[model samples]
Target chain A: MSDEVKDPKDVLICRCEEVTLREIEQAIDEGFDTVNDVKRITRAGMGLCQGRSCSKVIARIIAQRTGKNIEELLQNSYRYPVRPEKFKIFDEEESHE
Target chain B: MGMSTAYYLTLQGKRVLILEAGIFGAGASGACDDMILFQSKKPGINLELAFESLELYHALNVDLKHDLGFENYGGMVLIKDQKELEIMEEFVQQQRMYGLDVVMLDEKEMRKRQPHISSRFIASTYSPMDAQIDPFHVMYGFFHVAKNLGLEYRKKTPVVGIEKQGNGDFRITTQSGEVFEATQVVNAAGTWAGEIAAMVGENVPITPKRGQIIITEKIPMVGETNLWSAEYLVSKLRPEVKTEISEEHKALGLGFAFTRSFGGNYLIGSTREYAGFDTRTTMEGVNAIVKQAVSYIPLLKDIHFIRAIAGLRPSTPDGKMILGEHPDVPGFYTASGHEGDGISLAPITGKLLSDMMCGAPSDSRLEELSPVRFAVVKGEQVQ
Candidate 1:
């Protein structure tokens, strides 16, 4: 796990952002610092699907680099209205339906 | 006011109730880019509070035992011209004086860090203190922890009316004929704070400032750092500052800002318009973001936009949050008017409001954020 993420040409870790392991390593090499740093610079996890797609791979890369266990790594916060529902659904009479 | 306040209150062993018009993260909290930055904050209590919140964010995941995807990506404010360089120079001085860890990055150094940055930028300022979090997870974590501590939540409930009882209690009637009784009512509603305050016959000079965002298809890290134009600071603090940008764009409050989301999408935005509660995304706003963002990071021009979105930020005329109890209404309190900083300020907002509600001495900073400040500012005779 530690040495596996060094290759920048690795397969897409995040398809939504189109981030690769190589770019993640470059972000870290360029002093991007933390997992969130790589996410901000390379967008490894910031995607339309909201990282449900690629966070695990990105986390694995981060764990490999930082020498931290994958389980110990920080995950992104979740927001409410977590489900996508239109405002019309909240209308008093409409909500009943 | 509702969720975070409930969290701290429940922790204090108090009975708590939460009523949401929609599900959590539905409002500004969910829609905002998860940046907890202090560089552009209005240099006094706002920066102080942001610093406190930054500390809270650092420990929050560990404290709540939830994964909040917190990271210090650092932030860079681009200086596109000599005027902007001067402005950033002064701004950096003020920020440093306020104990912020900010350093000026010349064009060469800035380019070294963020190679994709435009050559049009002469200089920039970098701060490691700026960071991002997944707003959805933050809210979810807070709600989960609060609920476990005995917080009661009723979703799909909208307050239709408010009546004051003879004993100083407030009775809130939801649209579905549900009634909620409480000794005090805190208006933590985002853009709807004004309407909530009006229900108690109080005025909280809050407005809905619409901010539009554009999300790009996942691509390699084209730009480094959470980037913003020095104009963003100018627009937020002194809207009158003149720039070569069109009056139309200026009116829309367009400024360049781009950050990578945890999901790999680049969330670039935004435009601030007083759209009277309308949260719809406009072509003009989205176009401005695209034009300005591509100008700073030319690589963005080749990328396709995945989605265009907008959110209504709760803003005050004076650009400060309104916390504490309303001056006239005994138990009717306010914890709104955070503007774009709401996501960053939620933790402290909740704790401070809860402290006041629990009969603890008010934080001296709360004195300035008093709901009464607006009254004093207007010199309006409180009837």
Candidate 2:
């Protein structure tokens, strides 16, 4: 399966952020194994989707590379406003309530 | 703070070990923005140390062999009214005398640099010296390099107790009941520095100032340089200049700092509230920050904010970082209470603390930043 892609750099894991598999691998090689660490260094999951799209794939990649259990790796915290939110919404009269 | 100090110590050929209460970058180091601002600093030791720190960052970018994401993206402090302009003009003059390349820009110049800025801002102060670096990269760069140089670290090992042994060595007990001994112990704990100092019977007044920042989705660059409002600085520098500030804004301690990250997201911030140790992002803070940011750059109003992060900045009473050895506690040192300037001053703090520990001839100017200022001398507190 790994041989299917001759170059990990060509594999785009995070479509929202346009992060490639090679970038994630490089981050892991540099000792940023956790999803959050890689997310910070590579911006793989910090985009419009906020890791919803690429976190699992990145975790699997880390697990495969680092030989760590997928469950053992701490996941990034799920933050508020589950979807993308506009700044004006907060200023709305209803949001204040 | 601990990691960078450890890195510097390792560079000095000292056997260093770091005991962290949590994982790396779990605290303010990870949660804060990447600004290494110069305009925000008062023209004093803080500014002096910031200049030295920026130089060190350039060297570290090469020495660490990693992209620290260091960028010389200049900064601007927007002035809203005649009152703010008056204060900022004097402030800029003082900074200019201190060798900072800063200038007061008219509304035309400000708009030429930041087209998205609201027309309400009458003027701004621009400084090309203002810069930023990715905190995570810098932190981990120190960690990896120092580890390669024989530095050891134990994550999740919170120091539960500290005691001086009869043999003059310091004994440290971790939360996991592990014991370690060292001849010298440096308290590089951020907000928890006070607690760590108390364990050794030293007094260090470090409070946690909660700063909340919101992240926007990847978008086009709104301005040429990082942005800050003189309104916040006015309130801090000249409290006599009465301006209509909302109760919500006051409570949240809302301010504006807008910077685009390497990944192209605008890291808009922030609030400065004395919320103790609560690092939770409040709805009020997020709303205030968004409103303040939109007021400065109306283009941000339509942007989608994806996440809100809060960090507890280790604030001191005087706003200067506490560095140097305790007066009575020999072999004990502290390098904390940097508050918002932690990222800006991390490298210099580490180098200076390491130099102090190594008994190297140090700068006399650093005497002003000593922890001895907070020490109780003969039942009389020293200012």
Predicted complexes: DockQ each: 0.05, 0.63
lDDT of 2 at B17: 90
lDDT of 2 by residue, B287-337 (tens): 788887877788777889998999999999889899999878899999999
Relative to the real complex, the DockQ score for model 2 comes to 0.63
For model 2, name the residue pairs that clash. none
Docking class of 2: medium
lDDT of 1 by residue, B1-383 (tens): 47778888888888888778865556897568888878878679999998887777777778788777786778999887887787778879988998999999978889988998777888899998888887866876787788788888776688888888999999999999988899988898888887877777788877898998877665677556888888767655555777787889878988777887765667888998988888778767766677777678876655667567789899988888999998678888899999999878988888888889899986786798998877533455433
Candidate 2 segments whose C-alpha is farther than 4 A from its true place:
A1-4, A7-12, A17-33, A61-77, A92-97, B377-383
lDDT of each candidate versus the true structure:
0.77, 0.88
Interface RMSD (Å), every candidate: 12.5, 1.6
> Which parts of model 1 have CA positions greater than 4 angstroms off?
A1-97, B235-241, B375-383
Report fnat for all candidates as fractions from 0 to 1: 0.07, 0.75
